[model samples]
Target: MSPLNWGVDSAAIADEELLSCVKNNYGMPDFWGRYLSTVPGASEGLTTNEINFLKSNGIKIMPIYNNFRNTVGKQQGIVAARNAIYRAKRLGIKDGTVLFANIERFFEVDANWLIGWVETMFSSTYRPGYYHDPVQGNFNEAYCQAVAQSELVKNQSILWSAEPQTGVSSKTKIPRFRPQKPDCYATVWAWQYGRNSTECPIDTVLADQKLYNLMY
Candidate 1:
């Protein structure tokens, strides 16, 4: 089995609170998967201070660009990616960072459009990853199909499967959600087992021995 690591992701965490807790508190997450923008526009990306604090603290940052509710077609893919990259750059998220395209549950992602978005990021100096539920949702499997059917997409994508209500290491032995390969990526880079509000909370995952160097 591939070695598992623990981390936390949040869409609503404040900058000051995150910095204070991560610095003073004995426990804090190894990595942060923060939301860059909610839609395909120059929306609320992270602030300069927040970006610097996380970087200065040696935190591994994974950016999530979500436009699930918006109608994103193949023609609009370039526009969406451009806006996302612009927001990321403004917030100090440098190029070459792996940014996951948020494929929210219940929303159907167009194969060509998804591929276009991934390719756009690749050309712009950023890596592409997919964030979605592995088994329970249709989007996960749909994206898997998209990648498998497209030679272009298969080479440019990474997977971040979201199977909440569990953890990287669960003593309870509950079944974990793992995305099917080829349909999903061959390897899962990250798995969101649970949220900071429930299951294995941020403090618990941050304390895991396997993730010690994640925060540097």
Candidate 2:
């Protein structure tokens, strides 16, 4: 969950009903979208007041991002991404999830950033992995089989909860990838990730969980 990251881009999010639906289904899993101010002149960095508020209210914090400085597929972005992961680790904000915005064709997957992330995040945290669009032939199956390649994207871990594909609604049903029957909302609200028309996933789980486990 977490990372209103991309959700911040959805025009449909402005709808009151849908917004409520999204928040209920996906909010907590979603990281606080635009709350952090990372740069030096910036006015924020987990203030004592906010931390107290969260602690008082029993909220667990997982601040998003390494930095908004670089483009996802560029060398700079890779370094930025690595720095962000390191920052997260240093601040003890590593438990939730991280959207690996990109490792696109332009950027080689084996860059130092990805390698460091695999090493650090695995040793210190339990979070999701978000990656770039896959290339046509990822060095002949090496890319396709992310198991050995990317530690975070390990399928068996089921640690990742992807965004529901742009099309479709819960009314749509997919049989094969029905969340393996876990009742975590972070695991619900389907997304059409594969060619399959339906797959009840983390977002689907969110739909149900937030309906009951709500917060402002």
| Highest-scoring model, TM-score | 1
- Cα TM-score per model: 0.73, 0.39
- Would you give me the overall lDDT of model 2? 0.34
Could you list the CA RMSD of all candidates, in the order they appear? 5.2, 9.9
| Cα lDDT of model 1 by residue, 94-192, tens digit | 666777777766666666667677778888877776776666646655566667776656776766766544533332332343533334454455666
Error of 1 at 50 (Å): 0.4
Question: How many clashes (backbone atoms < 3 Å, residues ≥3 apart in a chain or on different chains) does model 1 have?
Answer: 1
Off by over 4 Å in 2: 1-48, 68-82, 89-115, 125-128, 131-145, 148-162, 165-216
lDDT of 2 by residue, 172-205 (tens): 3322333221222122322223322222122222
- Output the lDDT of residue 106, model 2: 44
Candidate 1 clash pair list: 144-183
Which numbered prediction scores highest in lDDT against the true structure?
A: 1
In model 2, state the lDDT of residue 170: 36
